[model samples]
Target: SRVSLVVVLCLFAFCSAEYFEEEEEFYPPSRFPIDPDANRTMCEIIQAKGYPCEEHYATTPDGYILGMFRMPQPNNVGPPVLLQHGLLDSSFTWVLNYPEQSFPYILHDLGYDVWLGNNRGNTYSKNHTTLSIHSKEFWQFSWDQMAEFDFPTQIQYALSKNAMYPKLVYIGHSEGTTQAFAGLSLNSSIADMLYGYVGLGPVISVTHMSNLWLRDLLELGVEWIWNVLGIYQFLPTPVELHSEFVWACAECPICCNEVIELICGRHHGAFNNSRMNVMSGHEPGGTSTQNIHHWAQMVKNPTFQKMDFGAKRNEEIYGQTTPPVYNLNNLPKSLPMMLYSGSHDELADPDDVQTLVTTLEGIVESVYWKEVRKYAHLDFAWALDAVDEIYIEVTDIMRDWVEGI
Candidate 1:
């Protein structure tokens, strides 16, 4: 079936590597921005927002040292909440918005300490214990490694520091959600360490997405070739150039909006036109080529499973002919989890979200689902009315959970 799908795709769209090469060249090398926040840290961004912030680091078992921003109130309270950004995103997404609208700030103001975790290879957490960030070994990872290493390390680190709260609530968006679900499923014991889990734009299997170019790019295995060519990093464009494109010159009204619609389906009134420039300042923060390749696997394959390391390596690593599916059945039965999906989200299609929910049926306890009719992939984090349409309901749900109601 996959073979036929690829065949059919080749007939409809140009499968020439030359075409993709001409369209999306390897990002030219980057120069640090001359802007004010060029060297800004996550804590610095949090502090700039007038929130009491602290930067913390935790070293994963694989030697990647992850960084997180902690916003604690003077009167620190129980049930700290950890927010993780999606692929090519950092903690900046939570703090980039207005204080009243920002999720992390809102939570901090609500008497809850908020922690934002950055996955390895992102802008914030690029340091490794030994390997260079440019090493092919450093790039030899996907979200599969993340679920196994990043989440557990960060959670344990947070728990150790905030001993006041025995457990903290976990929230993840997009790829963050993928790893959280995948990690927790494989090692359900991690669930015992959390107050609850929340997924904003949760994604697992994405074969049903409206966009097939991403699936096309991935199915062609373009990323593996880049790796072999020694291009370890996967910045789509440099932040410097990104800022120029968004800030100085662009189409009057629908410039950035058009591009976003091209990637994520057109969901009008979700993104603020004025703030697009500001959001671009810190966005497309970071990720690995392998991570994108891994994501493309999800986009093409229906099975919610581990990385497809080809048949030979799959046999060597998994002792199987194919990659094993992450049994959602293995998720702890009592783990309280909330999932928010958007109807217009082409990337996290409603059908796929339903499939995830269906797979977890009779397996987990206290699962809550919310579907926003007009929201798209980015809207979960970027929508102007998010506070009223999404965050308030989320906080209310979290409030009830905190009160053990």
Candidate 2:
């Protein structure tokens, strides 16, 4: 009887620890079979997955053609929300994880009309009226142009389509937040139309950032690198480079995780590791070197403001010795805003977020502080449990605001 009991216990332990075959079947949709080429357009990917998606094109005042995607509601009976992607990322960021977990999809499932913005110079928004992609003029823009031109154009376009919705909700990540702040600063009238703004990993002041190497690089200056390498586009992913990285990530997932950990913050297993290959296709999508230089300028500068163009040029541009700061205090107190930030985000450090919070108390509404402990920067998009830990709460808050609850 004792021998039989021992054998039964051993068999139970083995069975409980499922083998690779069984575990593989349970991996999330982000795991494998992601076609980078086929999924280039947001509509294509969403339609492929049995969701309704529509592509809308908007022309910036500066003549750049920006692409925005819409997941139209079934009966036009939902609040409109516009989501913008971060630096070197496209609209695809929102839909990287499983449909149930993705923010855009969740918003759609919750009866929100969702729109995704693609900024100028990304893979989707690469075309301009007269300027060729190879011309230096095409690569001359920074987040400033994105704010003054792209943001307003896209917002107006979305507003035009969804006329019934008064005052659209704006949600932005990383550089997206920067553009909104800049746009609103330049034209506070824009704030009059926004019902509320939700910022994820809002990056404004990076002078006190935690990334030491990046900080050092900023201090030293990044303009010289562009000149030395003759690089017009910063970190442009050639088709070969994209494919190679994707293939490497797929074949050696552990190595890929280590690389991300070394560059980004400690993962703490927050990100869905298997989806790195899927993410690689869209990341480092494309950006002008000038834009990166602008960020470097932000890091080196003491205040949250416009890009510095040296004393002489600054005098010419701003009629001052130094580039005047964007007046954060100028924002309307009635314009509702909320910020979502992670504690471990190296780029948008918690301290920097605190600075923003302290500075922007006038227009601040509700804030969802770091719910997931030790969540890093990219985890906002890639964290496997983000739906449960982050999105659900965000949706609840936005729902209340939409319903006037």
Candidate 3:
């Protein structure tokens, strides 16, 4: 009888375990490519339209194979636009929010071939040839390595295949803007290839922003946990966390509800709750959960290039006690660069945008500091009522620049 009871207990435990496992599998936490079917559908539709969208792999100098989407221009257009996404975002981030009216679709409509770039460490760009992501060596890279290596590789490969001029027009958002500046400043070869530069919600400095309280708390938590785990520098995976904030955000509407409330309360003063809901969804757009961790690293350690190791290392790098501010001296004195900013962007203040523009060496022929009086950072992409205004302005600016070229 005892032996029979033991067997029954084991069977019951196994069945329970299998049941939970099946339940978890049925409901995946929200992450990028939110709907795989939606992503596959979009890819299929793009291909069916005859533009030839293919998955292209770009190997970083460090031998990381970054997944990229190549949308060839119709009739082999010259000098394709290299579209780089912001932090915690993949190329799909561009297409997800404005499935019918985003920049990529609009640019494609305007006869410009678009190639979307996904930097290393994102979900799609996580493979490495020589190093494991589980190791510190993989996480050692920052925006410095991206500008110096990844951007150049993508541009070179694009140019080689098109048989067009190597220099291409560049468009980026947020960290995308920062990487563009770093790339142009450090790699003059690539800089010269850029026909014109466009930045959306550009972030040069965040000394004015004050939305970092939650980030500060999270960083402190991560540091303490890492020390406890005997892992000093490596990032922790979502699966090993105390809370499933990432997963919750994916599967639970309550998480999105809280995020919308927090963001709206902190930034969007007097904005409609319905509009706020739409904006919060658009801020993250279609970024994956893992990408969010990579962004946390940048927020914790914001440097134009890489982390600074204090006075001695600064002296070694810049030949001075204080490290030079990212060597902005190399930025083209007369390059036509366009910076767009929202007035209420706490993260990327319009004032700071102006400061960045003024600090640049030469007279930027055209500077449109659109004070979308009611505009916030999230609004740039999400404002259901304001996208047309934003799109028209951007299209006009690009059209003028193209005409000049």
Candidate 4:
């Protein structure tokens, strides 16, 4: 009887396998292959691509551990160049793809010590000395903390590590530029320590930003609503969600682009949709909801200003009825700066960029309003035509500056 039971169980198992195989034919699982390599550290990813690299870490003033990856020059001859990525973005932005299109790879090939920074709260720099990610203290930070504590700490670490150079060159994109402006504006010494700055889709003034819905959300005290809802970190990419999203985007492109366009503005043909599928896993990597609140506060306020804590708290923290504005006029007049802005950029609207240019007339070395039509905010970093439309010109400028130095 026991032998007969064993034989029956084995037959049932075989039949189940066969039945599932037949079912699989009728409803095939979606298999949009994602680039798992994106999960690697900046250094690990670079080394895997057969490049020379090193990882560096710095503890910020408030105890956040920031990460930076460096591509060393063989001779160690030129001034170091530091590249800072935008909000919810990691250092990988500098080397997101092939050497032909990557900013860090191009700079390394040009013989400069290239360093890419991962801002506080990003995947690479999430660890802190005293706080856990689950704690409210961890999410308590905003761009204010980044400007006051994170950026300066990274700059100090980079300069100290690369003591061979008297000063370093800083390149920032989007919120990278925003935090840099805040840091350098507050601390003159930090601004003076840089030989120059290059802002790629820089976000200095968002008074003319085109995202009305986002502006309305911020203006309507959405931060308080989110706080009540217990949502601190915004748009954190989970593994399962990322996989599902990759499939959705790949299988339903038209539908996906409509949603993406609503958030990041028009991409048209400028963006490589295939690359976006890969990038989606990494980008909007993660950021504090407070940071979004900071941007919203900026939108509601006429001047480029600090974070708002409402009337009573604003008076207590800032010693005034209103939040004090960051004085853009105080930026070092002699520091060389090259800025690039796209015509169709919705987040960093062209008109707002022009306002920034006018604000820093003497300091701006050059302003490139890209001629390529339909170029939007994300295009500077993610567009398929980035190499021809932006990187070539950027390389030329960097070459000239490096040679002159």
Top candidate by lDDT: 1
In model 3, the clashing pairs are 30-250, 167-193
Report the Cα lDDT for residue 360, model 3. Answer: 65
What is the descending TM-score order?
A: 1, 2, 4, 3
> Candidate 4, residues 235-320: lDDT per residue as tens digits?
55544444555556556556666645555667643554555555655555567878877887777666778887878988998999
What value does the lDDT take at residue 164 in candidate 3? 52
Q: Could you give the candidate ranking by lDDT, starting with the highest?
A: 1, 2, 4, 3
Candidate 2 vs candidate 4, lDDT winner:
2
Candidate 4 segments exceeding 4 Å error: 1-32, 36-39, 75-77, 240-242, 246-259, 362-373, 403-405
Candidate 2 residue pairs in clash (backbone atoms < 3 Å) = none
Candidate 3 lDDT over residue span 106-166, tens digit each: 6777776678887777646767899875565565566666677777887776666666555
Count of residue pairs whose backbone atoms collide, per candidate? 0, 0, 2, 0
Q: Write the per-residue lDDT of candidate 2 for residues 1-405, one digit (tens) a residue.
A: 244323422322332221223222323344455455332556777776678988888998888999889998877657788999888678988887778768998888888888999999886888888898777788888898888898888888888887677767898988899999989888888876787888888888887767554555465565675556555665444443445557667666677666444444455425666676766666655677688778877777758666777899889988998877778777766677777788778888888888888778645444445534677777777777888777787787777677632
Which candidate number has the best TM-score?
1
The models' CA-based lDDT, in order, is 0.75, 0.73, 0.57, 0.71
Deviation (Å) of 15 in candidate 3: 27
Give each model a TM-score. Answer: 0.86, 0.85, 0.72, 0.85
